[model samples]
Target: MDLPGVVGTFFAANTIKRECQLLLLLREYVTSLTMACLVEDQCHSTLCDALVQLCIEMRSLDSPPALIRTDPASGFTALCNNDLLKQHRLSVRNFLRESEHGSSKKRIDLSLADKVQLLKHLQLPGVSQASAAKKFGVSTSQVSRLVKAKQQIFDQFDTGNHNRKRQRAGKEEEVGSALFLWFQQKISQGARLSGPLLKQKATELAAAEGSEFTPSDGWLSRWKSRHNIAYKKEQGEKQNADFPAAQHWRQHIIPAILQAYNKDDIFNADETGLYYRGLPDKGHCLKGDELVGGKKAMERITTLVCANMSGTEKRPLFIIGKSRQPRCFPRDPSRLPVDYGHSKNAWMTGEWFAKWLKKWDGELRCKRRRICLLVDNCSAHPSNVALTNIELKFLPPNTTSLIQPLDMGVIKTGRVTTEAD
Candidate 1:
């Protein structure tokens, strides 16, 4: 037989299946060796030793060798000539060296949600730890640890929708629990709260509890996240709003006014500032690139809108600008689309508001109609404006953004439309 050719075929095997097949062929050949071939000649004996060492190393690539040959002559005869067997042994050694260098283990981080899902998967009847680990891309030991803590994991999941990667609890547990209870009570009372107020309250609670807890910004943020709290922009007043008064007005005062006046005769008037020439405040740019914007335009106007309930009547817009006779106006002021007024700074003044209210009241009286005009309590709107047909009622101070009809969205919609134009 061509011994060098047989050895060459075994060395050419690349994949595991091919390598195993060749190994089996080599074993069979070793078993078929005649006593004549096993003769202890120096050259043949040297070749036999090399083949035995190569087979041991190859088998050790995956698992420990079941049995190692102390006497090479007992297992195999001389299979290949000197040069061929030497080259094959060198190739096997180099392959084993590379395999050792390339092996590495990496760690995987699993979130709480993922861990819960994995626990659920482990409850299947036919699944084993090894198979579950493979399915979840984790190790068998990790799966075992999760199984040990399955009860704790399930209990944590029931607390909230906390999908954090790691489970952690606040150091000051009593303070946090007490603070959350206080937060819930305040929210139930319809009180407006801000972050600074929450942090200050937390510090006070901690001090009362005899704990040295400092409510830093980071701690406050984490506490909020754990309790699922969010921050919203307070429209008119930050924390000074009188919720009890507003609630009382809504429950008692408002119903009396509604009963006394017709829905069509209840009017709301509000003034909003308009930056007619202002550009958008936000723009998109490539990441890591500095964004440049044009200087903001200060050209502004004050517009007053009046509308009655039942959507039956809408007065013409009253626009106040800095210039009484703006160059943009037509030669005739009456040709303008809106009622034009003027102030030194384009702001509504008490005199102008009183004049406007008197004009509206005179028109209502001529038509033999009485109306209730609801306006916010601002310095410009005098409660003493004298009118026979117009009953001026001011909203409780600092509650306009919360309860005023025009502020609910009317002014915002008008501003958006003006900007679009």
Candidate 2:
């Protein structure tokens, strides 16, 4: 009448015919044993006798008799159910094997950007720590740690290294910080920065800080990745620009000019060359074959752009063409989209600049306004122009690429817009 033996036989048979009756009888026996121990203060022998009687009544009708054995050491009789004991041992072995395999697996690591995205997801309403952990395939404690370290994660976020999984601290972190500040200042002044230049600066900064740090190509690359810095191709003579002169002008000369004039009264003007009918420099061809095309059209024009510091006013573009009256021109010159002028080479000349400045000066005089005009030191832009209503300021020679607003993507944007049209 062993209960475990009777239950194991029915389970092996895969029958549910007597499951409800067995469950009800077991519940009744458990309740009676509890009440007898608590209310009647039953002795140990009385409880054992009650358990044996309950097991005998609960046994199935067709189950084989359970084996009875005596423990020789304790002199106690016990029921032996081999099938139930074997099944229990098998389940325990499987559980232990799974635990060993799961413990041997490696843990997944999240990147800084992934942590940032997790933080964003967690910030949304109605999301709990357990839910976030499940969604990101991480532990709840890991999610909690990330929430606590959110500020540090955000401070270290770099667009260039979004996929980088590890955070590392360098010996020259102080030098990098100072160099990044210098880099930002130079960029604000429109200086064209290169890798070698940055490396030299880093070395100098490290020396100033009394550190024996050598700036290598690898270090420079890591620093660039950390700060999300990139290089851009600079066209024309800007690569060999006078950055020192530009820095001097920005630090000393520009402040005085800015103090003297209001932002609305300050203006900058520059001219850019455009090949109005040029073809695209790229083409598609089959593999192992050269792309061939006809000679590109080089019909070029010069356009002048002028704007105020506050961006409150933009003058109509001044266009210069090679022909005074080209066949494409309408009968009336004033009907053109831009203010039209002409030169032999379709370029701005000293005479053309002087005339344009004088015309603008006259207009300002009529309005009773005295304005400061900033222009780069091109040969066409003269410093000796006599104007009562305009104070002409020329940028430092060879430093136009570093300090001139027109050359700093402004003209490029204009040319792109024109091409799109």
Candidate 3:
């Protein structure tokens, strides 16, 4: 370059590289400038800023600056004097280019121009965020963000079928397509059994595998609109007793209590854990916060409980056997910190219950009134020894939910009431 319109000191190879491409060209120009400063002779945030200014003030555009630097020196004033040069010299001097390829199997086309237009074309063709992410080797969120910026046109997930399949309660597993596929496969295989056969197979599978009892046909039909189709047995259904003392109380005692007291004096009593496992965590949990779950959730903490609204003397008692002492509190100074990691030093076992009963017995003798103890018919509470010591009462099966005062009123709850389920 020779320049008649402009005059000044030629910058030592004054060229733009790795620069902002506002004008939709000069990809190589920006790259070269950045590489010029990036390597042993390369750039930084400051150097890069200077390089951009230098690119804007070359002699060919107009009069050149006397020296290249960030400070507003003599050259800068002289360069800025040319208003035409300032407006057009380096219009595309801000864009930063990134890696040319993406992760997905989609090919990256090296268009001579920037990819914003190509992305827009793909968007107009109904490319989805996930598809665009796959094609561009970016994350789905990145594609979504790009699409939101109008850099591309992306389609959202189709939601019509999902709205159709969401039904009430445990019947949720039955997907439309999965059920259809199951029936289709069944018919295709000549397994068209009658209603009796279908019932029989379902019953057999239910007895054998619990989940398989639900005819796969309906579930497969559900898969058409959704992904999840298989049924999962609810937790602890096997161990749950068909009848609970709380149930008995709600059915018989609560009605009687309701007749006498307007449900408020139907007070119940049950001691719970001070620091049991599965307590609702206190504070907010960040993304990485997790309690290292294991076989621990099912492990019970020993807690004693009794609740009732009726006669004080006829209340049922409960003792969760699996619960043990907390690990946080260090034991006696002489012993190892983990000596009684989860021991009866805290839990009220049968012996402890007997002692506790002895104290209550003393209190009862002083008042000369027989005390009524309302309790659930749990194994530990109903043990021959635990029951013999008190005027024990039991609630009706599953009736604790409705009749339990805790459920009716919301007091300042202390911790997880590990009482019923």
Candidate 4:
């Protein structure tokens, strides 16, 4: 009875069998679990409680046992468009018929289903005399007589509305544009009309405009709301890499390079968007109502955060940036653009840090030796120049947050970059 395909047979016997089997398995599993709890000496407290409840049943001297209905759930029986009771009915029927050959053979034992099912298997759907006969489990002659009577009655009642699809109707090119403009006008005017009123309004308009009319009701009202376009974008999330950089930092890099420096001279540095999750990369988003509102309102407009941490002291510097997309060098020395604007900010790159190291340790004799700079293992972080002055143990392959102070809490996480990036 899987019968051709699942949806093929409107009420396929196979579908019923599957539904019954699922419920059977669920009931069996629950029973077995309850039994296990009873038989085992070390059963969990909750399982024992469930086992006790499972034994509640009514038995009589000469009748079938009745279920001791404990508490009937009281509330709305209909959940929106969902019918929980109908679903429960399938399960309930399966539960009662456990003695049947197997749960897999359950089906709707109804006249309509039987007739339709036979007709489908026989490759006949037009409901003919002979087809109906075999389909309905009746004599062929009997079906022929019933069909003939119905056909005669139908012939007498020929309605013009029957089989409209057979009409070879064509459409004009401007049909769409005209309909949209007309509907928009009606909606803007807040007009509401039905049946005769709708037809009368259309006729007057047609006469004035010297064109025919097409009036349809309930069509506009049922359309999707532009205001409720969709629920929050069910978009996919982006990932920075195969394994999080934070993982690499935690497992491979920290123990080898940064832990020793942590006892004396080590500090973490990073920057973040002024906006709260303006970039939803790798950070916790504002929950509840904050997210319920528009995403644009949370966008950081003109600010960047430069943060540094040493010992327990945390420094937060809010910097703003200009809208120009130019690459600048620390040694560019070209009198930083006067009109770069007050919002514009800058950071010294790896190459600049290297030269600064040479000046401090070689030329200027600054006594900052054996210094460890805790930074992410981004390609930008470990420059040849920076390595010459300060030792940067590249964060282990994929670790970033597990042990890295930056990903842990010191600095805010960045937006999850796409794999293509």
State the C-alpha lDDT per candidate: 0.67, 0.67, 0.39, 0.35
Error of 4 at 232 (Å): 13
**Candidate 1's residue-wise lDDT over 1-421, tens digit each?**
2233232223321111231122222231323321112222222233345455546544433432122122122112112122344433422222232344666644544556567767887898998988767655568898899999999878766653334556468768778888888998998776879988988888899899887777888888788767657688656552566677788889997898899999999999999999888977766789898778889999999999999977799998999998979898998987988888999999999999999999888998899999998898999999898899999888888777577898878888888776762
Query: How close is every model to the real structure, measured as TM-score?
Result: 0.49, 0.52, 0.29, 0.27
Q: Candidate 1: where are CA atoms >4 Å away?
A: 1-223, 231-234, 286-288, 383-386, 416-421
User: Tens-digit lDDT track for model 4 on 1-421?
Assistant: 2222221111101111232121101122212221111221111122223322332221123332221111111101011112232222211122223345554633222122222333343455566666444333346664444344554324322422121212222232133234435655775564543445434554555556676756444322212121111114322111323356555554766566555665345555444444533433333456553433334545342322222335553333333344343465234533543212223234334443344335433521355455555655565355455333355444554445344556554343343331112
Q: Deviation in angstroms for 107 in model 4?
A: 51
Q: By the lDDT metric, which is better: model 2 or model 4?
A: 2
Could you tell me the lDDT of residue 32 within candidate 4? 27
For model 3, where is the 10-residue window of minimal lDDT?
91-100
lDDT (Cα, tens digit) per residue for candidate 2, span 1-421: 2235234122110001242121111222222221111111121122234334443454444545432221111001111222332323211011222345746533446656567777888889999989767555467888899899988888777434554557676658899889999998998787878888998999899899898777899889888867767667767677678979999998998899899999999899999889988866666679799878888788999989999888898988999998889898899988988788889999999888888888888998899999998998888988898999999898888988788877788888877777662
- Sort order, TM-score high to low: 2, 1, 3, 4
Model 4 lDDT at residue 136: 33
- Write the residue-wise lDDT of candidate 3 on 224-298 in tens digits: 324322233443222344445546655776566456543323445554554445434344557688654344344
RMSD to true structure for each model, in Å: 25.3, 26.5, 21.6, 22.1
Error of 4 at 334 (Å): 17
